[model samples]
Target: MNLPNQLTEREPIDPKLAVGSSLPNPKGLLAIVLALYLVNEEKDHLDYSDKSGNTIILKPSLITSLKAFFNGITGYNATEIDSLASANPLVEMQIEPLQVPLQLFWKIAKINILGTDSSSGERTGGVRFPKELFFTTNMDILKNVISNENGDITNTGKELIYSWLTNNNTPTSSVNIEQKLTKTLSVFSEETLFKTWNNSTEIIFQQEGIYNAFDTTNATVDIGGTKEIKGTLRNLKSSISKDIHPYLKISSSNVELKNPSLATQFDNYQKRVSNYLDLNPKSIEIKIVETEEEINVDDVTILNKIYYGAPGTGKSHKVNELLKGKEERTERVTFHPEYDYASFIGGFKPITEVDAESGKEEIKYKFVPQTFTNIYVDAWNNKDNEYYLVIEEINRGNCAEIFGDIFQLLDRNSDYSITPSNELKQYLVKELTSVDGIKGIENGKMKLPSNLNILATMNTSDQSLFPMDSAFKRRWDWEYIPINYEKSEENPSSHYQVVVSDSISFSWLEFIEKVNTIIKENPNLGMDKCIGNYFIKAKDNSITLEEFINKAIFYLWNDVFKDEDDHIFEENTFYEDFFPIATKGKEKVLKILEKIGLNTPEKED
Candidate 1:
């Protein structure tokens, strides 16, 4: 039996029949494979029945092919097969043939495993490639069968089970594993997932099957959602032992820890599994659940709010935090000087389209919907769900020019609906009216859907770029993100520290606070151009002196006090310490701030 090259000579096998060693059911197949070897050794027969009462029979012709294939791949003679199986045994290989999709057969030149769905060729559940065929098969042929596909998972339940076997590439800790399991279980009902994992693990023939700790009765502690996986891991660790260490050993089947040698075997298995998981991190399967949160559109008060603040005040971060889990419904766009009506709203744009018959690319103009219009249609389609269109640096673009006719949409009536103009109506009718769930259009006028929410962020410094009129400003509820030094320092997550030469390293939080204090005190340089804590972040809780001079000092010298009184720059208390570094070009500038000192906190002795 000669093997064909799977890569170049691509071939398709009968999908209905279990071809190749793609063992979809690893636990069951492992039992069947082990049983085949054991039965052949003890009784010299190829007959067995699994827990499902499926009879497995191995044919001599298939066995001969497997023998040759094994010798060809492993370079072992037929006589050495048993010894090969005993030493360095294939206990659990991740890329099981049965678990892989049928379409993946094209990936490997259609190498087929001969086995019963239960055994060999008995046809209990249908014709399946036997376990002996899998044991003798090339391991490389079975690798990455589930992964390397750019499509949706056809069998999500099987993929989750596979994740349990492989542990999602990070086996040392159950963090990534549990995350995958939690994400996978999110798709099914809490009850269904719990039941599936519970029932999937059953010792077949009482002697043949392999089961995992994740499939155990104790592992089914949580099927709630992604949030509950951490608790589930804790339950598993605590429930297993009174005193669980960082690395607790979960034993393999029939492995007793009565002696040190037996305990060592369990540890080895754990290490091997962990290493395999680290290598194949992508193997963990998860499904992002739609409609994770339930939000009522009517209850929303601030329908149009602009988060206004100084640069690096975390206005965008605040918006993300507000819509943390509901990211599917939100779309973001950064506005700039070039942003205009055509880019902000739907317009006819030249796009290249390939002519299918001619096989040529042709330039044509089509009505392309922009961020706002696209979100509008999507919100209308999903009326029950609230949608957000986040505009970053809203002040950078000319609001009047960019908004154009759609600016009227901002004017909401008592019920929070806007009447569109005749021109806007023609465009909406042509582009959106026919779309699913797009209602409320009447007499060439339209209303903003109740579910659609517009969120924008603006930097106070960039407010001069496109000064919004009073009417436009009136429409939006302004939320100010103030620069609070105390609040910045209080955040335990930000471990940002600055270590300056010739001075004690101070908290980045403290440095920004001191700078902002001086800026506030100066009449000419007020709050408008004050430095925020987020302006200069420390890399690994450490900032270089050069970086401090470049970012923190440069900003104050350039932008903050550019047009302000030179006396403000000459403040001895504020500008002294930075002058020695600021000397090369500006003699007058350095003379002014030569004695400017920053009240950085002294390091504790």
Candidate 2:
């Protein structure tokens, strides 16, 4: 139950080695050294003098062995290799023997890049130790054994071991092991570590894993000899930082709480650390002003903001502008009528898996994650960066059905924290508990981190498609993008002329203004039916007759006026100008314009 001394102790071992011994030698010797280090006892320090006449010098220390092993295997200097291992947020220190060594080997098989045969492309039947033992690196031993002859160690047993370590594939400088080690460390984040731990379900440090088991200040040794969390959080922090087991098994009944509860508390502490890493403001203070006034602050924290406007009103454009210049994680998804909980969050899906015993393939259902689950986990990991999830056309889908139990996550207290339902709590714990380097879960609940912002864009016209209840709307701060026909004029480079046949060429800006005004003034055609200037953008500053007819005209006919009576347009000109191809030209369009008294030829000049 005691936290390992490795978590709380570091010794300065000033290692001195023989001159001219730093150059790259064969990897076989390095593997033997590493194998010896992994299988050594607590007091045992590796020494090259034990192997008679061997000039290589290795000091026994985790950091020293890691440095020498990496330097020798990949020709990188010890300093550079040391940095590579330390760069990861989580560093797995002790390789404990819980199950049999062979079973443990298979447990880490996915992460093990070693132990392959090269020339024949097969697994080498190396030495397989029968029993599970601490500090042992599981692998087949070399067939060649070094013999002590004439007071000197002879034979290439170390070289054979190195070949076994690298799966018999001698790594060249072009395809070296250093790059593979770097990649493994880079991809090895906290979440993945927790996932591996959860998968392994084995203790990282046993009672005898380290020295000075009883000598600790941050934690207390209970009667049953298990270490318990003291009032302070220093021990938990140290344990997690060194990748020591968070909760140790205890036999004492005097402990204030059980190991499971202590683990949960430790997890919550990790979540706060994750929050602090992102530099996001943890608190938000809102003051109600007595009068109408604008308040500006040097620091802004936008948690959940939604934009609503008519179609083509530049809602998405505004979102991009808001996120500009920020080094953040951003994901976008659109909600439609068919969008469901399984697609938004995650749900079980059927897949085929080979049965280990039967050696036959069988169908099984596993939880497949979608957009929300991915962003949720990412937000926890990259806490130092802002994470934005943009939901475009949120109102188009049934929000009630999509959020399901997760709807409760939207209800933040004054402190901007959320308490999840029991169902959601169980689900989150089950799915995310073992994720390495992840933090911020508490009592089976989580709050949307201050850095994780949910931005949604809703077309006001599509309100009828899926009505968002008052409860849902209340959770989000809404920003309205007003319809402005002259918006194109704000950026003259985007302005264009709409042409229909030979005699009809007019400014698209003026056409939109005129059409929108008519639609607004007509009681039957309300504001919802009014056109936004960006509905049909000009191609090369000139909108062709065909382009305008297909995009703008089609939308007006099908989306806007479909519910309106035909008499809304003067002399049924709307239908005639767009109906028959023979009459759907400049002459017919001009006649309709004249009928509506909108034909202003001088406007183009």
TM-score per candidate: 0.46, 0.48
User: What local lDDT score does residue 470 receive in model 2, on the 0 to 100 scale?
Assistant: 94
Error of 1 at 19 (Å): 48
The root-mean-square deviation over C-alpha atoms between each candidate and the true structure, in angstroms, is: 19.6, 19.9
Error of 2 at 256 (Å): 40
Looking at candidate 1, the ten consecutive residues that score lowest on lDDT are 202-211
Compose the digit string of candidate 2's lDDT tens values, residues 501-554: 555577776766667776777687667766665677667778776676677667
Off by over 4 Å in 2: 1-300, 324-328, 356-359, 413-427, 430-440, 485-494, 562-568, 573-583, 595-599, 602-605
- In order, the Cα lDDT scores of the candidates are 0.47, 0.46
- At residue 366, candidate 1 shows an lDDT of 72
